[model samples]
Every structure is written in structure tokens, then in C-alpha cells.
Target: MSLRNITEHTIALKDFQVQGDAIKTHPLSIGASTNRTVNGQQNPVIHIRPGETQLWRLANIGANIYYKLHLPGTRFHVIAQDGVPVGRAYAEDTLLIPAAARFDVLVQGGAPGTTRLETLPYNTGPAGNQFPRADLATVVTSGTPVTRAALPTDLGPYENLSHATIADRKIVVFTENKAGTIFYINGRTYDSSRTDFVSTLGTVEEWTVRNDSDEDHSFHLHTNHFQLMSTNGKAHDPTHGVYDTVNVPKRGAIVVRIHFRDFTGRTVYHCHILNHEDMGMMAVLDIVPPGARPRATHSG
Candidate 1:
């Protein structure tokens, strides 16, 4: 995407740049960059057999873009989220992807033709950043059909935290400062000396996160994946599965249950928006074993 905007416009062949003095506030354009050369247009091609079922791994690896993927001729059987397999597959025509999120999907190829992987425009809010829609990539199917089987419904040996007793509890609130420029989590910013919350290893914790800000924000943790228990005071479908990161709607709340298992270290949770994190919407999380005691407590 061309954020190196207006000042560099004359250098490029096409008028692919957004025209404005508010370069920092304008939406970004899309472009595909590779190891050798950066293509202002998407020239990447994916080949597939007409009748084969392919596993498509979709990731919003971009730092700021939110891609809502749409494939007109295909249906995505979402099998995983953030590399963790879901309990069951979900069939959807479009999938919303925030920054730092991922989805593993199974797709049965349609008739021999080209399919465009496109991103529709998304409005986070008047206060949140808005990104223009753009085509991400293209997939072409050729050759004769191949034998295909139905999507497997089973995701093996996944932990069910719903039945687990909650050993700890926390409420994370996201809000903005009075000047409306910076973001705050739990009324504070990132301070390594100040850990926001400490979770013990081998325990289950239920957390409620509320977004008091005017813009949409996403909550992402480093180590453990969490299950969505509720959103805005309603329980989500059990089959919706787990996520490593989740979108916290403006002025709304989300409840998730997490199991700290087999790992003990310091990690962090922050808004996936890169600028937001740099602006103090991040905090440290220390996970210690049940008996260990050698660190600071949550100050925020």
C-alpha cells in the first residue's frame, strides 16, 4: 500500500496515491510486494485443480489494514483461527479479518475459471481509521477434476474451557484520553515496570474486556489462545471455537475464558493497531507457576 503518498506521487507511473494534505489520516492503497520487485498491482497467481479441495490459510499480516475477504464463486469452510483448529468448521462467503488475525479455511474449487480474492471496504467508525477496498490476489483453476471428500467435522483433542472452574478474574477496559489523540488500557499505557495483569500457570481465568473508546479495537495476547464466552452480555455459539485475538467493538464488551497451561513467562496483550500499541495501549503480562513469586504485580 502507498502511504509514502503525495510527495512521491510524481515518481510513480499511475495515480495510485491518495490525494490529500492529511497523508497520515488518509486510507491506504493496496499493492503486492515480493522479494525482487514491488508490484503496484496484484500479479500473484494461485493454481488449483478444478475439483480439488485446498486448504487456504488467510492472514491479515498487515500492520493496520482490516480485510474482509470475499470470494464470489467459493465458500470457505473455516477450520482454524490464529493457527488453532476450531471445534467444527464454519461455512461462510465472507470473513472479516482484523490486523494480526488469521483464519485457516478449506475450499472446494469451482469450475475452471479465475477467482478473485478481494477485500471490501470497512468503516471502523468516524473516529477509527478507514481503509479502502482492494483486490488482494487471484486464483486460477485448471485441468480435469479430482476426487474430493467432504470436510471433516472433527478437530481432535481440543481443550474445552467452558466446564473448567475459573480461578481468576479480570476486567480490561479500553478508553481514550480527553484530548482524543492517545489510547489507554485500564487507564494507563505501556510501562514495562508496570505489568497490567499476571496470570498463573495451569489455571483458568475469565476476563471481561470492555471497549469504552469511540473507535473499534482488537485485543491480542502473545502466548495463550482464549475462548469467547460472551459478547455484549450474550453467550456465543459453542461451535464458534477459540481465538488468539478478537475484535472489541466500540463501547461494547467481550468475555473470554483462557487456560494458562504448560508455559510460564512474560508476555503482553495490546491493541492490534500498531500505532495504538506504540501510543500506550499495551501492557505486560507475566505468567508464573503456582508457586513462583519474584515479579511485580499489575499496576493498571
Candidate 2:
């Protein structure tokens, strides 16, 4: 029951169906929609003196959800995204966390008042699922005022792998045919015998992923992280940080650079949506060992 309640706060909530009247009859059998708290109980409160500093590490474990974490008055000095620590802190009030993404933020406990960690509803697209609004936890103060920690002035410089050095470029397409019943990647279903992408070990490549569907889908790669180069043709500064899974907006696109390192075997890239992945929306990536001959791929 606790597991189901927490998932409602994530993108995985899209799997639940609304039965009968949405207002009266419960949409979920686990009784999550009413009280966002765990098992309908009050959430544990974090104690901190006013103006005290805190380092928050957040991770999205949902199968397929996107949370735009908002702190309202509290500013988030993000130092890392995914597992890669940025060279410096990126300050913002709201951060977009896709499925399986991680973020490390530095926050200062501000004025003493009851405040909740809230997540607003995100519009995926015409075909995307509707996720409800909810609160994750409550923030409380110890009633004592304190000085804030000195913020880091500099971490280091963030550099993006240049396109000039890219040995190859791959395309990822999210397809949902109006007449088709299931999702697909690159116009094909997942088959272990088939390889969709192949690259030489220790080489970097560029990938342009497009969501041609009516809903949003998160593109997640296993065993590696990538740097975002541009979104819908706009250059995205690499200083923001690198990420593992990124949202492909409906009819939108992104270009990212990735490196194939160390281990060389078959891995995967797929939509973080559990149902979609289960229904054949995934592909295998083959990283050939250095000096080994590349295999003939089955994808265009």
C-alpha cells in the first residue's frame, strides 16, 4: 500500500484508471488520490533552523513520470544532475526531473512556516496521461534562526563533447500510430536478436531523439549518461549539467552527445514508461570492442 501511494506522486500514476465518477468514486483502489501523504498519514517533517543550509539529494524511481520539483520561495542551488556532479551550482526555483533522474540541490531553510514539497501537474501531450497534483513531504523549522552556509563560488567548467569529434550520429523516434495498438521505437518492436545501434568502444556519438507521438516519453539509456546539445534547435548550454534520461516532448526533439566506455556488450535504450517498454518500445545498443569488427545493424 505504501509503495502504491508513493508511485501516485510519480509518472507511474498514469497506469491507474479512473473508474465511475472521478469526484466521488475512488480512482485508485489503494486510496492515494485523497491524501497525498503516505498511507493517508502525516508526512515526517524535516527540522532545520531558519536560514540553515541543507543538501538535498532527490531521485525519481517512477517507471514513467516527470516531476517539476518546485520550492516556491526556496531557491535550489543544484550542484549535480543525474549521477554526474556539475562543475558549479545551478540556481533555480523549479527543476524538471524525468523518470529515473537524480538531482543534488543545496537549499537554505528559510523563514519558519509550514511548507510542503509540492509537485504540480504536468501536461505530457494529447495522448499523455494526466498526473494529479500532490505533496511529497512537509518542511518544518526548529524555531531557531541561524546563518546560511557559504555557497560554493565555483566547482569547475562544464564542457560538452564537440560535434566535430562525434564518430557517429543516431536517431531515436517515438512512434504511436493512431491505428496501431502498441508503441514502437524506430518503427520496430524490441527483438533481442536485432541490434538497433552499434558504436565502437571508447568513442563518442551524437543522437537526435524525436517524439512523434501525441504524448511525452522519457528517453533513458543504460550504462551511460549524455550531454544535451540542443532542444528544438536551440543550443542548450552544457554548463547546466549532463543527464541520463530526458523528456522528449510531443512532437519535440533533442540532440545529445554520449560516450561508450569500459564495458562493451548489449545494453538498452527505451522509454521509461513501464507499460510502453513492456509493449515493445525498446531497442538494443551494441558497443563493439576496440579494434573489433562492427556487426551489421538491423535499424535505419
Candidate 3:
């Protein structure tokens, strides 16, 4: 199910030019594709046979805001993340989904009853907006029961970067002005003509990304996915797989390892919050062929 947040107020052309903080206060109407109702309206329902397992491909395609999804009394057997199959499946009662992230999971129908698929209250940070709880859809299991399908123990092999030799290491810092009107990476607003980072193809590099602002930022990269190594000095499980977008906590840091393979060209790394990107929390990244000299001057 694709999830998105719609604005309750009329979106004007000037809205697109607003700063990130100003955009945060806009009223949101969050809903799923199958059932797009808002504000106390009856939610669309899905009927399932009890004990039957179904694979649900969920994607958060919204531009801003986060979804802390919960389906009480059931667990989601997550098999994939961001469309990439994980090394192994894991179960969780609540799934914290950021914008642009996707997860494929196996959900088994519970006893005959109606339950609401809802998002819990999520407070990003003191400088961020607080999203209230809302129901996305309803799941009703009332048909004849069926045998439950066995969950997969393993999905497939994933890139394990634990023992790989790192070619280089870089640091990225996220910051913003006190007014939150303009955002920056490494203290510079995004300049399309400027190449902020340059790397070589066929190389693995580690990056330590720090967020110095008071709000959370979702860091996203183009071209290549990255495996999270640690968050705030805490190591992550190798099986967590790779993702193109990950959250960087306010005033905290995260470590990620990226393998620049195959493709080489100019792309970008940015804060996934749409308004933040519009306001300047982005930088250019150019990946050149191995042994090829970089064409443009870079900040780092």
C-alpha cells in the first residue's frame, strides 16, 4: 500500500517557495492508496481469510512527515527494505517509516474481527512538528480460515561490507540558521554549479554524517545505496541491509558505508524532507571512473 499525506488547505504556487519551518505547520491528511479518506471519514477495509498470509508491499511516498505504523495484536514479518530483500526476515510490532522508504512484509490474518491500521503519534524533535495519530485503513478477517504460510528464514545474499577495505572516509554535517529559513550541509547552501563531493567508481567509502540542527533529517543519496554501520556510536546488525535513505537524529550522528559500483555520474545527497531540499539542504556528488581525474572543482 502506498501512503501519502495530502494537504487540507489549498496549495498555492507560493507554498512551494516557503521555508521548511513554514511548511511544517500545514495541515496534513494522511491516507493509503486503497482507501483515501480523511478526518473521521469511513476508512476503506480489506477483507482477509483468517490464518492466511499475504505479502504487503508498503511504501511511504509522502514528501514530508513520518509514519509510525501499528496494527495492534499482530506483527509484521519484514522481508525487504527499500525494495531490496534483506539477508533475513525480522518481526516487529511497530514500523517506523520515513518518507520515501519502502518495506515488503508478510502479514498473517488474525482472528475474525475488524482492526484499524493506524499511525501513532510521532514527534520528530523540539524543532520539528508533532504528527498526531490517525487511522490509515481497516483490516477485517471474517471469511473461512486457512492454513498459515511458513515465513522465510532467509531471503537472499546481501552485500556484507564488514570486512571490505574502505578506500576513503568523509564527514557530512547538517545545519540550519536559527530561523530555520535556510538549511545547509557543511555550512554551505546547495549550489547547483558546485560539486560538493567527488568519489571514484569501484571504491567503498565510509561516511560519518552528523546533524547539528535541533530537528531530525532524513539523509538520502542517489545512484548507490548504503549500509548503515552505526548510529550515535552504536553498531548496527550486518543483516540490516542497505537503503538509499536513513534518518539522522538531531544533534546526533550516523555512520554509513557506500560502495560506488558500476554507474558513475553526477548526482546528489540531500535531506529527504522536501521543503528542506527546496530551501537548500542538499549537495552535489560526482562519481568518476576509476583512475579518472575529477572534472569539476569540489568542496571536499
How well is each residue in 4-32 modelled by candidate 2, as lDDT tens digits?
Answer: 11111111112233445543332223223
Regions of model 1 farther than 4 Å from truth? 1-43, 178-180, 297-300
CA lDDT, candidate 3, residue 245: 87
Model 2 TM-score is 0.83
Over the stretch 81-149, how does candidate 1's per-residue lDDT look in tens digits?
Answer: 888888777898898877788888877777899977677777776567665666556778888887665
How accurate locally, in lDDT, is each candidate?
A: 0.73, 0.72, 0.78
Query: Any idea what lDDT model 2 has?
Result: 0.72
Runs with alpha carbons beyond 4 Å of true place in candidate 3: 1-42, 298-300
lDDT against true structure, model 3:
0.78
User: Judged by TM-score, which candidate is best?
Assistant: 3
Task: List the RMSD of every prediction in angstroms.
Answer: 8.7, 6.8, 7.2
Clashes (backbone N, CA, C under 3 Å), per candidate, total 0, 1, 0
**After superposing candidate 2, which stretches have Cα over 4 Å from the reference?**
1-42, 157-159, 179-181, 296-300
**Model 1 deviation from native, Cα RMSD in Å:** 8.7
Between prediction 1 and prediction 2, the one with superior TM-score is 2
